[model samples]
Target: MKLKSFLSNLPARVILLIYSVIVLYPLLWTVTTSFKTTNEFYENPWSMPKSFQWTNYINAFKEASIGSYFVNSVLVTLLSMAICMILSFMAAYVISRYDFKAFRWMKKMYLVALFFPVAFKIVPLFQLLGDMHLLDSLFGLVLAYSATTIPFTIFLMAGFLESISKEYEEAAMIDGCSRFGVLFRIIAPMARSGMITVAIFNFMSYWNEYIMALSFITTESKRTLTLGIAYLMEVQRYATDWGALFAGLVIVMIPTLVLYALLQRKITAGINVGGLKG
Candidate 1:
């Protein structure tokens, strides 16, 4: 029995190891490539640098306006995510706790919104933003991204909230706690895992968002990381700097990697707990 159990687990372990390598190799290559000189990168694209060119990162920042883009990206991501979480939490709480005639319709409406493709709405959204005098602005981009993300975030949060027992809220109410008080004191703490997961998801989405930011933010300094990376591609048209480009790529990837590493456990736990309860 022991031998059979060991054999059964061996294939899964081997597969996991292979998968991990596959996922990590591109990141490793990007980091190593960032440290290679341009000549070295061209000569040995597949191998590590003979001598690391640490100045590539400096060049990327100076030449590509990576510092400006990095700050813009951080601001956009943080603001959008903050709005998404706050709005989604409130919407989810209402949908989960309240009994109303419009509840079913509201859920269906959110589901429809979640599944709808943003491409279809681009023209109308642009027109609307133009009318509102919000075109080519970061605030407009924030509102757009928040609107796009809210449906799904609300859905996830609502599902998680629905899984919680109503008794907690009832007990809080019996003790004369207001609705807001119950939410902040009892429900929000319990829903911390789900909130973290939603925050991470929203952050990732906003960080890598390209099309909306590109369309809404025309000013050079206002461009986010994705647009900045794209500008690097354009700059390479006349003078290609593979090392600097890779360095910029590495910089762009760091925040995402760090965030995932920090929140992965909470994300998994949230999904698991929400699933079991729901």
Candidate 2:
């Protein structure tokens, strides 16, 4: 009987196995290739390394200047993520809970804003940033990323806030909690999973972002990791180093992988529950 039940679920298990292999194979290939020497790679790209070249990672960091780009990316991603989430959260809460003039229209406008392709905004955005003298600066990139992400973030967080009960807000206010305190204490905590989802999604997006970085950042010193990776591609045009290239990719993938691993449970929780009832 047990074997029969297991067999009943066999199709689902088989599908999952296929999906997992599809998702993980490229990452596995990249990591293993990073350890192969140039000769080993040219000899047999599919085979395992005869001798692991840990120096690939060192060369990526030192010679390729991934070290500086790593710091730049970390700073830009964190700051932009923080600003975007905070602004999105506040806007979402207000739209969900309050009734004021143009409130419905405002939400509709944000819905429309979500459809505006970011690439379309580039010309005007770059011009505006140039006028403000923010081009090529980290702060400029932060502003650009935060603005680009806010509309969708608001759309997500508003639904999460709307799903929460109003009684909690009333109860907190009656206990002498200020509006800000209620948000920080009650609402924010209840919405933790949604916030984490947004943060992780946007962090990864900004961390791996290339287009905006390419358009806005011209100075080599201000380049992001994504931009630095592009530089490696440019170097390859002159002299290809597949090992270091793969090593650089592994370096780029590591932080995102570690962050998601740490917060994997939070993602499932967000999908499972919108908000607490009480």
TM-scores for all predictions? 0.95, 0.94
Off by over 4 Å in 1: 275-278
Off by over 4 Å in 2: 275-278
Model 2, 207-240: lDDT tens per residue?
A: 9998889899999999999999989978977886
RMSD of 2: 2.2
**Residue pairs in collision within model 2:** none
Clash totals, every prediction: 0, 0
Model 1 RMSD vs true structure: 1.6
Superposition TM-score, candidate 1 onto the true structure: 0.95
Error of 2 at 51 (Å): 2.1
- Across residues 23-108, which tens digit of lDDT does each residue of candidate 1 receive? 99998999999999878877879998998898989999997899999998988888888888888899889988888869868977
Give the candidate number with the greatest lDDT: 2
